[model samples]
Target: MERKEYYAVIFTSKRTDGDNGYGKMAERMEELAGQQPGFIGIESARDANLGITVSYWESLEAIKHWKENSAHQTAQKLGKSSWYEDYFVRICKVERDYGMNE
Candidate 1:
């Protein structure tokens, strides 16, 4: 099933310096996000300094719920304190989308 409208949360960030458990935390967060209500999909990429992740949801409420998740809150604090130098989150409405699979 596919929805004609949805929401996307785009997360862009720059790393502070080292691993400092960032890798494990990121993986864990992704895993946890997959279990959230209204979660549609996620795409992510990262290099040495920059990282960008986009998560899709069915509604703003679903996105909000994920943002307020307990473990996610802790990860946010850890990100600010130890992992990320800077970050930005953008929410966009997806009116239409299409893709082809080979």
Candidate 2:
């Protein structure tokens, strides 16, 4: 099947100097996000200093719903307070995508 237009929420973050249950919370959030109405998938990478996570959704409204989720809001607050040094979130329209056919 051909790919269709979708929304992607790009989250880039720099973390503070500790674990502090970030791993557990991140895992939980991913699990929760998968259960959301518009959630399609998520890709993420992290290192000692910085991390990037992108989540795909069927629509902008779905993205907004995930953003306003109560658990996600708590996680965002905790990120600002303890986990992240800085972060940015960008929502973009993914009009086209291609992948290798190997």
Work out how many backbone clashes candidate 2 has. 0
lDDT of 1: 0.93
Scored by lDDT, model 2 comes in at 0.94
TM-score, per-candidate, Cα-based: 0.93, 0.95
Off by over 4 Å in 1: 100-102
Best by TM-score: 2
TM-score of model 1 vs. true structure: 0.93
Cα lDDT tens digits for candidate 2, 14-96 = 99988898999999999999999989999999988889999999999998899899999999999999999999999999998
**In model 2, what are the clashing residue pairs, if there are any?**
none
lDDT of 1 by residue, 1-102 (tens): 446899999999999877899889989999999999999989999988789999999999999999999999999999999988899999999998876851
Model 2 CA lDDT for position 56:
96
List ranges where model 2 is wrong by over 4 Å.
none
